[model samples]
Target: MNFQHKTVIITGAANGIGEAIAYGYAKEGARVVLADIDEEKGKYLEEQLRKGSYEAYFKKTD
Candidate 1:
């Protein structure tokens, strides 16, 4: 849908479903906040999203 100026928060985003959802939102032009316990994976995903020109950030939630 239209996520031009929306913000989305996704937990467990280091991999699997949460990661998928984060990318979906990012692809739809939403600012995505990814929360996960795995810092490296979370940061890697954030970097990937950024490289693809999507607004994304990683937050440690555990």
Candidate 2:
């Protein structure tokens, strides 16, 4: 549960279950890498996480 210096790469992270998981990782202090085809949602989530001071990045992936 201690993800102080860990990185979590999650696919389909733009919404639904994956989005929830991404938030979970961020809450646990992990650097979250969101990989998804939905650029808009991914970027939006990225911004939201970053706004909360969590390390988050969004990558467009197919």
Best by TM-score: 2
Best by lDDT: 2
lDDT of 1 by residue, 6-58 (tens): 99999999899999999999999999999999999999999999999999999
CA lDDT scores, all candidates in order: 0.96, 0.98
Deviation from native of the Cα of residue 8 in model 2, angstroms? 0.4
Question: lDDT score, residue 28, model 2?
Answer: 95
For residues 11-62, write the lDDT of model 2, one tens digit per residue.
9999999999999999999999999999999999999999999999999999
Question: Which residue ranges in model 1 land beyond 4 Å of their true spot?
Answer: none
Please state the error at residue 23 of candidate 2 in Å. Answer: 0.4
